[model samples]
Target chain A: MIRRDLVFEIGRTLIAIALALLLGFVIVLLVSEEPFNAFINFVAGPLTTTRRIGNWIEATIPLIFTGLAVCIAFQAGQFNIGAEGQLFFGAVTATIVALTFQLPMYLHVLVALLGAMVGGAIAGAIPGIMKARWGANELVSSLMLNYVFYRLGLYLINYHYRDSSAGAMVSYRLPETSWLQQFWPPTRVHWGLWVALAAILFSYLFLYRTRWGYALRMTGLNKDFAAYAGISVSAVIIYSQVISGAIAGLAGAADVLGLYRRFQWQQLPGYGFDGIIIAILARNHPLGVPIAALFLAYVRSGASIMSRMSDVSAEMVAIIQGIMILLVTAQAFLAKWRHRSVVREAKKHGLNA
Target chain B: MGSTLKGIFSVGFGYSMLRVTTPILFAALGAVVSEKAGAVNIGLEGLMLISGVTGVIVSAWTQSAWLGLLAGLVLAVLFALFMGYFHIKLGTDMVLAGIAMNVIASGGTVFALFVASGDRGISSSLASKVLPTVELPLINKIPVIGPILSGHNVLTYFALLAVVGVWYFLYRTPLGLRLRAVGESPDSADSVGISVSKMRFLALGISGFLAGFGGCHLSMGYVSWFSRDMTAGRGFIGLAASALGGVHPIGTAIASLFFGFADALSNYMQSLSIPSEFVQMIPYLATVAALGVFARRQMSRERKGKKQAGREVA
Candidate 1:
């Protein structure tokens, strides 16, 4: 039975991927005359070079953090849509600490990471507290927080932390002591990948093995039933949010201290939204998040390489991602296919219901 | 200082508020209709975004604002129909589908921009035409209020008319009742021979039409061109207003006006030497505040009901 289920899951994933590719190909054929070249570039461009592989790893690091963050909240039935805002706040907080301290390299990095956690926690807790205390919908609160943090980041970058020499909305460079050590030479990929892996392992353990985790899952599945069984539903919701926020913040810290030389104020990177897609595709499983993140990162990296290699725009990859998401989220189509297959098998066995 | 204060009042902050509210009013009304039919259309943002681009593109190409408005609405309606087919017929999660639609719309517009014009953002500098303001000559001759009400974009007038139109449709019409019945209890509606799915699809289609017009107003009426992600968070803001307004057309109109007033105030304050960043934060801050208030009220009502049940048992 287990083998059958695994096979079915793999089949579903493959089918979805195939459909997405077909749709993307059709779009490309319509738009570009050199469709075959574009298709080849889109599929194989990222695999051809070492530097591109490094870029994939670099992109995957933050996605791993944010994806895991989203997974935790989603599993708890709390859609923490504020990951983008939380990431911004996290990066800013880490930037502040990384700039202020002149400690040892390891200590500086640790402090920056901790600051990111705190920043994310505070930002994440707002919606959680509002939901718990007053019944404010977490979805709206979290989404609104994205705009707030975006403007706040802009304010800080433009006025308070401005590196005037940069000539735009940017901040001062962090001290070298705070910088994360690189994993490979000539590539920007750093130790953040290891940190992300550790986070994934920790999240998996926390969700599947712990008593608290079980209770949190119970609460998520049915608040009324969980309350009847004497679980503190509100507490679990709040805790899940804070943890999710911290993870997202860590992602921001990883980006800033591990990669960027100086803080550039981005309104909000679509990383949070990407994380949402990852969480959904992974079915909110901690172990599945990293895989999904890697897949998405690979697509992004591949698309960039393809853009460089051929006339096809990298934006075509986004179109594919959107179509895939639409198909996956609309499970009715999947259900219909499944129903048809089941009916056909039953007919063959003369066991029609 | 007194003269400045009077100028602030006389400068028609109310008109500015109305101008800002127009797009939101259309969007909030769309949300009300959709929500009343049991389909949560979180894709309002995407619908508006795509419509905005379509309106700008068509207008720029044809040099006709009306053509742009029509194109935007038509595309919006088609998108709504697609969403309805996926969610109502195919049983997709509304929120996820909405998010996907948004991402597709945003990315698609940017891609199309690159294809249409070599620019990655803020469409062709060919100086596209905008919807002209219609001046009511006789009305303009009236007092201060006349100038405030008259000489506005045609879409603005349409938005005002939509408030009453939506209210009447939702309250007085049989179709509206059926839509509400589905929203309240779809199982019951189904048992009574009402096609819950059909009603939902129709509601969503209407929603898409309204949202498309809203987008047209944003691009053709207000700015005359499309910029990347130019709708910003107005669609989401409209959703919030719809919720805060208790999903009623009149209430949503009021809420939209309040939000628009906040937006206009921020813009006005920015002109008075205030930091633009700080000014920009006002609308977002207001959304949070509104949500906080709405949530608190809901909690208190639940608590009160619980207390009443406890007293009755005693």
Candidate 2:
């Protein structure tokens, strides 16, 4: 029965993806004079070059981190949107360490990332604690905090840490030793990929194998039941956000260290918002996050390529994303079919007389 | 410091506060309607963005500000209905669907802007019409009160009217009562023969309509051109305003005025050698703090009530 349910979930996701793509194509056709060329580029352009594949992987790494972050929070049934703020503060903390500390190579990288995680955890904890302790709406507080932290990060970068000679509002160049070591020679793919993959594994194991994980999932399933079962639901909520924030912080550090030379983000990098879509698409499962991230990254890469080669803008991908999210979360989209399949599987396994 | 204090108390500050509050007040009223119906429209941000851009473009094309306003309102309603269809008819989570709408609006507007004017940032090249300002003859000559009250954008007056209008609609009308009843308890509303979904949809439509005015006010009255992200966080701030007001229409208008005052202060403080970033952070920080305090008070009240109930049962 579990197997059949998994299959149906995957099947529903696939159908949703297909419909999203189809709708994307129709939108392109309406906007682009050379609709065929635009559509083809959107569908096939990402696979056209090694460099593009590298770009796709780089994008996928951050999504993986943020996706895992979102999955953890959602699994605890907390609508904490503080990941964006956490990621921003994390990157700022990472940059501070990268610039100020005089540690040796590996230690410098590790310490910077650790600082970032702490920073993000603090940012995440505020809204989490607020929600748990006072019953404040996590969604509004977190959204408000996103702006506060973003402006604070901008202030830190623009006034305090900016390299005067850089001409733009950005931090001093990160030391080469602090950079994530590139594992791929021909492309800029770095060791952050490995960390992201490990995070995926860690998230899955933690969620399914640990006592805290059981408490969290149980709380998410039913708060009354979890409390009756002697779980501290509020503790789970706070820590779920904290864990998510730490992972999101890791993502910010990795993306900065792996992809850029300095802290130059003027606005929220928006990876945090993208993470919400990935988490939903993955059905809040850590194991499914990377696959969903890859799918999003591929479409994003394709959209960018299409924007360059055709009349269609890269923003077209957002339409696809919006459509995909709406369809996937539509509970009744294939409810009857899913129910019938579950019943059939039960009958076949002699679960029902 | 005295100058700063005087500056804040001056007529210019009051006038600009009303100007700034117009959009947020409209959005807050919109939020009040949807929230009262139990279908909170988190997509006000996207709805405003879509309508703001459309108002600019349509006014430019037709050479009539009213036509542009009408077109924008129509699109806002359609998009609201689209969100409604997903949340109400298709069983999608309202918040998630709203987020999706924001994503689509953010990207789709940029795409459309680029296509229309060959510019992705602003519609400066388009000759969009501005809504007229109303000047009260007698009030215009009334010294200190005159400047603050007289030469104001027409929409500013409308926003003030809308607060009272929304209050009346929610408290005085049968449809409004039904909508509130649905939100209060869908099962009870349904048992009473009220169509929960229909009322919710109507609430969403009213929200869209009010938000449409807010959008038009931004492009036509606040600024003469539509720019990328011109609404900024006004939509979310409006949500905060409505929430801070406990989703009451008159209370929301007052809450919006408070935020608008904060915004005006931020703008004013930039001249005082303060770092604009820190000053700008005030409103957002205040929102979080306000929500925390409000929630804390509400929870204590609920807890006390529960204890009293338990004692009664015992």
Candidate 3:
């Protein structure tokens, strides 16, 4: 019965996704003069070359980490909108440590990654502690921290770790010793892809297989009940937040060490917000996070390639993502549509299951 | 000592502070109202961003500042209504709806700019129409208070007036009482014949209106043009101000003013050979510190109340 129910849910989800894509195509058609070309580019643009596939993987790495971050927190019943901030904090820490220290290549990379994790954990813990101890709303706290982290990161890049030769808000270059090895020559893709996959696998095991994961899930589902059952709800919430922050921090580290030679301060990247959409689309499930992340990355990569090849702006990708999130989270509307469709099909068949 | 005092008095920090505070005060007033009605309006950031863009676009197109302000408000209210339909009617999660609205506004505005002007952001053809500053002629003759209050943007005065207006509406009116009751306990309010959804929707609409106006002030009153993400994190700062102020209109206004002072001081200090990046960090760091203080105080108060109750029981 459980397996049947799972299959039914997955089938319904796929149908909803297809309907959403059809609606999005209609929107694109209405908005664009070259509708046919735009639609074709959106569908087949990223699959045209190996470089584009590499770009898709590159985009998916950070998203997978950030999406998993959001998933862990959401599964523990904590809203962590500060993953962007955590990302910045982690990047800054990784860059500083990578620049300041001298070590062998493998050890240097490991230490920098660890530094990022620590930075993210600290940034993420603030909201968790605030929510758990003082009843401060995590949503507001996390959002506020994003600005704090942005400014702090910018300050570090401009004043403390600035490379004057660059003539922009960029930090000193990490020695090649600290950089991640490229998995494929001539492409920016690196070992970070494997790390992201490992993270997703561990997240799934931690959330579903372990005792601590079970406790966290229970707390997320019903905090009062979990408390009554002698679970430390507060502890679980805090732990999940810290872990989520660490993952986001790792993403920041990967972006800097794997792709860029220097640590440049991005004004804002929307990675954290993208993580929120991914978490929502995944329904906060650990196993669903990578799938959602990959889907988003594919759209982003395709949009970039399409923009280069056609007149359609890359900004349309954001519009499609917004629509997807809007449709996915409005589960009641999807449920109603599913119910109507199922009934209509049954009537046509002249049978009820 | 006399020279230092004179220098302090001569510096226009007080005026600059008011200018800085206006946007945040308006946005916080909007947030307080929406949150009180049990709606988490995270889309305030998006609303402000779109309004900021619309205000600049309309003003530049029409050569009238008032038209810009009107356009911003109308657009914000429309978005709010759309969000209300999704959250209240369609039973969508408020936060998710808010996130969707933000994503659309941010990316949509950029795409519209690209299509219309061939530029990625801000219009090139039209010169932005900035709102005229108002100088209180006779009132300026008065001593200390006049200088502080007069010769400001017209919207700044309105923002101050809104603090009192919001306070009265939230505390003194019967509608206010009903709205509060609904926010505190929706089921009880529903049982008592109050339309919880209606009240919540109204609150969100009002919030959108105020947030939109706040965005107008950013473009028309302060910067005189819209840049990409011009509202920056002011919307989030306003939300923090509301929380730190205990969700009271007057308290929120005061908190916003304090933040504004910090912001203005930071800007001023940046000209004095201070690192620009570090100076920019001041307001954000201050916000985190202030919020930390506010949270701790609330925690202590709750503990005190519990202790008193325990002693009474014993």
Give the best candidate by TM-score: 2
TM-score of model 1's chain A? 0.93
Tens digits of per-residue lDDT, candidate 1, A167-216, equal: 77688988888888887977788988888999999899998899788888
By the DockQ metric, which is better: model 2 or model 3?
2
The total of clashing pairs for model 2 equals 0
Give the poorly placed runs of model 3, Cα more than 4 Å off: A4-20, A337-353, B1-11, B142-148, B273-314
- lDDT, candidate 1, B227-271, per-residue tens: 888877788888878877889999899888888877777766654
Cα displacement (angstroms), candidate 1, residue B276, comes to: 3.6
Q: Model 2, range A18-51, lDDT digits (tens) per residue?
A: 9999998988888799999998888889888888
Give, for candidate 3 chain B, the lowest lDDT window spanning 10 residues: B2-11
The C-alpha interface RMSD of every prediction is 1.6, 1.1, 2.0
Return the clash pairs for model 2, or none.
none
- Candidate 3 lDDT over B112-224, as tens digits, reads 65665556666665477887788898888887767877888898988999899888988999988888888899999999999998998889888999999898899888877
Instruction: Sort all candidates by TM-score, best to worst.
Output: 2, 1, 3
First chain TM-score in every candidate? 0.93, 0.96, 0.93
> Which candidate number would show the highest DockQ if scored against the true structure?
2
Among these predictions, the greatest lDDT belongs to: 2
